[model samples]
Target: MPAEDDFTVTPYAVEGDVDYDRLLEQFGADALTDDQRAAFPDPVHPLVRREVFYAGRDVDAFLDAANAGETHSVVTGRGPSGPMHVGHVFPFYFAKYLQDRTGALVYVPVSDDEKYLLKDESVGAISDHARENLLDILAVGFDPERTRIVVDTADADVVYPLAVTFAKDVTQATVNATYGDPVNVGLSFYPAVQAAHLLLPQLVEGRHPTLVPVAVDQDPHVRVCRDVAAKRRYDVDKPGALLSKFLPSLDGPGKMSSSADAPGILLSDDREAVFEKVRTRAYSGGRSSVEAHRRRGGNPDVDVSYLLLYYFFEESDERVERLAREYREGSLLSGELKEIAAETVADFLEAHQERRASLGPLEAELPKFRLAEAERRNARRRAGFPDDSLAQQ
Candidate 1:
C-alpha cells in the first residue's frame, strides 16, 4: 500500500491505488457532474454513464460547442511502443462514439517519435510497432472523411514545426515537475510534441473546442499543453480533457498491463486465448472456500473480472447490474463471474480481430486517413510557420 503522499501518477507511470477524487483536487480538474453527464448526446456512452470517464478540465466548453452543433474535435492518441492491449484502444472507441453521435472530427496521433525517445527501442523498432498499431487503429472504423491519423515521424513536416512553436512556451522546470527529469534531450522536448498533438485539430480545422480523452494519469500532459495554449501564441482554446480511471489489470486492481510479458488481453488475442488468460489470471475477490464464498459473498468492486465487464465489454446496463447483484448476494461465485466476463470480452475481441484481419495493406489503407495537403498547410501556418515551411520534403 502506498502512503497518502507516496503514490505517483504520470504519463509514463501509475503506481498504487489511485484516489480519483483526490486526484481531481490535486490536478485541479472538475468531477463530471450529473448535469455534465446528462448533457452528452442521447444514449450516452457506457464509459461516460458508468463514470469510467469521471473527471475533466474545461469539459463544459467542449460540451457547449458539441450541443450547439459547432465545430469541435477529439484528440486521442497512441504511443506505438508495442502491441496495443485492450486498455490502449478504449479511448479510441470512445472517441469514435463521440464522432458518431456528434459528428465531431477525430484526430488520432500515433506518437512514434515519443516512443523512440521514451522506450529502449530503435527508430526502426518503434516504426514497426507503429505500423502494427496503425492497422489496429484503422480497424476501429473511424470515418475516413472525418478522422485524420498522424504518425509523428511520418508527419514530421507538420508535427515538428508546430511542436517547435509550442516548445518555446514550456520550460525545462515545468517538464521536470510534470514528468521527472528527462533522460535525453529528445524526451526533454517531447512535451512540446505532445502539446502539438492535443492542439492539432484546432491547428488544422481553425480555432474550436478540442477534447482529449485520456486516463487521469495522463492529465499532466494535458495540463502542459493547456499551459502552452494559454500562452496565446496560437488561436486555440486550451484543449479540454475527459479523464478516466486506470482499467483493472488482469492480476488485480492496478494499471492495465502494457509490458509484453504481462498477461494482457490483446485486441488480437483469439477467443480461446482471451478465455485462458481471464480464467487463469483474473484476480477475484472470492473467499478461500466455496462454502465461505457463499456465506460472505464476493466483492465485485475489487474483482478484476467484474471490472472488466463494467468497463467496456458488457454494455447493457441491466445485465451489468444483475451481474453485480448476483455476485454481491452470494448467488454468483467468483469463478462464475470470471467466466461471464471472459465470454463478453471474447465476443468483443473476436469481432475486433475479424475487422483487423480484413484490412488491406497499410500503405493502401492509410492514405485515406492521412491529413490532406490543405490541412497540413493550414496547421503549419496556424502554428506561425510559413505555408511553405518544411513542405513535406
Candidate 2:
C-alpha cells in the first residue's frame, strides 16, 4: 500500500489514495462550476449532477455549443485489450445521456493498435477483443446517424493518414513526458493517432466544440491532443475534457479492472453471476459484528456496493440518498445494500444484454455507424491530404 499522499495517476497506472482535487491542479484543469453544471442540458446526468465528472478543460465551450444547437460532439472511446466491464461502460452511457438530451454527435474510437503495442497479446487475439468490445459499444444503442465508430486497425486508411498528418507536429519528447517513456516506437507514435481520433469530428465536418469524457487518469491523452490542436496545424478545436473519478473496484477504492487477475463484473455476466460477485467480493464498510454495526452505523463513502449505486446503477437521487442515509444510520445492513446494488446492476446488465442479443450480425449493423466515404475523404483532405493525394488514391 502507498502512503496517503503517495498516489500516482498516469495513463498506464493508478495507485494509492487519489486526491481528485489535487489532480485538477496538477493537470491544469478547472473544476466544473455550478453555473457550468446548470448550463448542461436539462435533466442533467447523474454522473455530471453528482459530480462523478468533477473537473474539466474548456467544458463551458462544449456546453455552449451544445446549448446553441450547433455541431457539438462527444468523443469517448475504448481500448479493446480485454473484456468490457462495468467501469468501462460509464463514459459511453454518459455520452449517450448527453446525446439523447442535446443531439451531440458521438465518436467512438477503438484503439486496437495501441492495445497491441501495450499488451503481449497477438494481433489475432487483439482483433477478437476488438470485435467483442465493439458489440458492447454497439449495444449501448447510440443513434447510427449521429454516431461514428472508428477502429484504428480496421480504419487505418483514414486513421493512419490523419495520424501521419498530426505525427509531424508531435515530438518524441512530448510523448515521453506525457506517457513516461513508452515501451516501443508504436506506443511513442500513438499520441498522434489519438490526436487524429480527438480531431476526427472537426476534420470530417468542420471545427466544432468536441468534449472527451474520460477517467481523470486519461486526462494526459486529452492534454497531449490539446497540445497538438494548439499547434494550429489543422483546423480543429482543442478537444475539451470531462474528467471522472475512478469507479471503485469491487474489492476497494481503486480503479476497477477487467483483466484476468482482478476480474471485474464483465458485461457478459448474467444476473446470477452479478449477484454472486457482489455478495462475495464487494468490499463493505460495516462493523465486524451485527450488534456493533447496529449501534455505530456504517460508512457508505468507502463501501463499494454503495459507491456502485451512487456512481451509475441507481439513477434516482432521492433513492440513493435514502439508501445512504439508511446505511449511515445503521438501519441498512451492508448485505442489504449489496443486494440492492446487485439487483439494480443486474437490471441494467440484463437490459444491455437484451440489446446485445437483439442486434443483428456485426457486419450488418456496423456499416451504418462506420464513417461514410465522403466523411472519410473530408477528414483526409482536411488533414493536409488533397483529394488527388496518393494516400487518398
Candidate 3:
C-alpha cells in the first residue's frame, strides 16, 4: 500500500483517486499538447480529440513517422484474467482506428502467463479466459495482414526467448521500485515479458517507431521497457506511449470500470442488460427530489451516465454539448440522461455483438492474424537468440 498522501498506480493495483497531472510529473511524461493531438491522422479518434487520452512519451516520433509514410506500429495488449469489458476493449478499438487511417501495424499480445502468476486462478482457468478474450479481440476487425496476435504462453517459443534477452537488462531493484515486491519469481520476471510485447514489432518488422496506448497507471511498464531499449542490447527504438484516464466505474469517479465488483457494460451485454445496469447501477448527480433537481440542475462531471456518453458512446459533439447544457439548466433529468446513455451504449454493443457472432471458429480465424513463420524467426534472431533456439521437437 502507498502512504496516505501518495497514491499507488501499477499494472496490477491502482489505489487512491489518481491525480493524473501529478502522476505525469512524478513519472516524467509530458502532457499531450494541442499540437501533438493535431498531428494524429485526420479525423482524430474521439478518445484522443476529447482528451480521454491526455498524456504521452515520445509521441512526436510516432506522429512524424506516421505523417511521413514511414513504418510504425501500435502495441496494445490484454491480460485475460476474466471476461472482456468495455473498458478493456477501448484501447483495442482506438488502435484499430489508428490502423484504419494511418495504415499502422497493430500487435495485440495476450498475457495469460502473467495473469496466472498474479491471480489465484489455475492455469486451466487462465487459459480458458485467454481463448475467450482472443475471440473478443478478433471481433474488433483489424486487418489480418497488418495485425498480429501473440499469446505469451502459446507463442512462448518466440515470446520467451525475447523476454529472456530483455530480462537481462531489467534489474530486480528497478522492477521492485516500479511494480512492488512480487510474491514469486514468475511475477518478478513478468516485466520482461511485457518489454517483449512492446518491442516485438520492431524485432519482427525491423526497427521502426511504435506507440503503446494504455491507461496512465500502466506507463511504468513502458518506462521499464524504454530503459531496456536504451541499454542498446537490441537494435530497436524505445516504444512510445499514449496514456489515458480511467473509464469511471458505474458507481462513480475514483473507481475504475474494470473493478470486479463494478457492474461494467461488457461487450457481451444485451440491450436489456445494458439498460438495467445504467438505470440502476450508474451513479447520478441530481438533487434528492425531482423538484429540487428541476431547480438545481445536475452535475454532469460526476454523473456516470453522462460520462458514458461523453467518453465514447456519443459521437456528435453538438448533441453532447446540448445534453450537458440541458442537464445543467435542469431540462434533462437524471433518469432521462441515463436512458439516453443506455440507448447509445446498447446500440453500440448491438453492432459489435453482430460482428462477433458473424465470425467463424476461433481455430480457423486466428491463423490469419498469427505471426508468420519468418516473422517469428526474425524476431527471435533480433532478440539475441541463435536461429535454432526454441527449435521444434
Candidate 1 whole-model C-alpha lDDT, 0 to 1: 0.90
Q: Would you list the C-alpha lDDT of every candidate in the order shown?
A: 0.90, 0.92, 0.90
The best candidate by lDDT is: 2
lDDT of 3 by residue, 251-316 (tens): 886545545677788889999999999999999988787898899899998999988888888888
Candidate 2 per-residue lDDT over residues 58-87, each given as its tens digit: 998899899999899999999989989999
lDDT of 2: 0.92
Candidate 1's C-alpha runs over 4 A off are 1-4, 388-393
Across 104-129, the per-residue lDDT of candidate 1 in tens digits comes to 99999999988888888899999999
Error of 2 at 295 (Å): 0.1
Off by over 4 Å in 3: 1-6, 258-260, 390-393
Using TM-score, give the best candidate's number: 2
lDDT of 3: 0.90
Question: What's the CA error at residue 334 for candidate 2, in Å?
Answer: 0.6
| lDDT, residue 280, model 1 | 90
